[model samples]
Target: MSLSYAYLLTQMVIFIPAIESWLRADPHEVLIVTTIEWYERIKASLETVDDPRVIVHAIEVKSKRPGLIAGIQRTTTDHVVLLDDDSIWSLATLQGLLCGLSAGPRVAGVSNIKVNIRMTLPALAPDAPSMFEAMGAGRHDRRAATNTAMAYFCDSQITCYTSETTAYRTEALQRPGFVEHVVEDYWKGKCKLSSGDDGAITRLYQNGRKTGIVVHDECAIEPKSKENTDYLKQILQWSRSEVRQLVRDPYLLLPSHRRH
Candidate 1:
């Protein structure tokens, strides 16, 4: 299938293994979009990639949500797969995502199950390098529950978004209405927010009565250690965003309005 892979780079330094993953996937294009401030740094790192299919662009906008909009607007393929630069994926995972997205026309996007793999460093032997170690596989590698965002039992309708490698139909994204919403969205039409990426993207697929499917073999392997306070903080941030949706749908909290 002809589709583009959109990678969002937020850091100044490039993740080498992530670049390798996209190259190995060998999709129609590996479009890496980074923040404008880190454009030069990321561009310099792009030199290592000699493939003609790789395209690196900078998001001029100052915010995260708009940055994603820039990538969607640049995509030329009928389908585009969104990826996190910090996460690495197997070729099989990409195949499954594409298959799930293309299964039906009304299916706007497919959310892949993100498995967080705890990262650990092996200590080298002091005596000598491991004698038994002959060869090693490089260019590789979630311990999280709630792998995908499934509907909950609230008024028989409780849907949320997935923050993983998701495949979305390009046609749905090109609409004028959705693009405008991504550009600038305010909470309660009063407070301006700089973030709310997952919720906005979820609407991208779920908009127009379209359905977002949670089907996959497995998505990206995010090698991160939750052994520190930083992990807890990140989880808290996500919880806050997820809860923001519940704020709008107050009936989710009411047993009278909710279904069994």
Candidate 2:
């Protein structure tokens, strides 16, 4: 049961913590993909680890999808786990995801549950809990409810699986259709997408040819928004991706295609 972990990097501070967690998980190999400019910096930062299993690949392309495709091409393991730099997982979580992939041959991928974390200003109000603390509490409750619905009412209806922390069988990803589904450009190549990788992959598995499962492990991810403008930009990008995907493949929005 060999596993390969692949992720793109932008900032050292965020990537270092994520790398630390991945090292603790002890995968067969770790694949880091980033721009050529940051390659040396990232390599230098990770040099103290002294682990031969870690491999870094620098690409000239600025898009995230191409880096991910390169990493997938380089993976030689039985399973590949695609992750985001902002997400962290436990060793047990990694084990659970691998176990899920072993359940069946048709299982294309397994996605773990995610909890959102946001930074808050606690210094402004010392007497009350920080916004981060309050939001964390609410997020957990919402996560519980979402998990319950997924387990009982919507297990077969789940169509979208997050790429932040997903494990896929190498064979499934090697399928010609799946590869094209992931790396294809939309809107006449005007948009080099940074988002919607998750949605695209989800559509492939939900197309009745394969299966995508949601595991019960906890995978924590930080919010993408640092300020109002950042949040708005993220929303706009996501909306554009969603619209483009719909135009490219309307079957994903159909009732039968989403019936698990």
lDDT of 1: 0.56
**Model 2 lDDT per residue over 109-207, tens place:** 876665433224344565544443454435444544544454344443344555567788887777676666677745567754567887777676654
* Runs of candidate 1 exceeding 4 Å displacement: 1-14, 118-158, 213-220, 223-233, 250-260
TM-score versus the correct structure, for each prediction? 0.73, 0.76
- Please state every model's RMSD to the true fold in angstroms: 7.3, 4.5
Model 2 global lDDT (CA atoms, 0 to 1) = 0.63
Which residue pairs collide, candidate 1?
A: 115-142, 116-142, 116-143, 117-142, 155-258
* Count of backbone collisions within predicted model 2: 1
Error of 1 at 249 (Å): 3.6
Error of 2 at 233 (Å): 2.7
lDDT of each: 0.56, 0.63
Top candidate when judged by TM-score against the true structure: 2
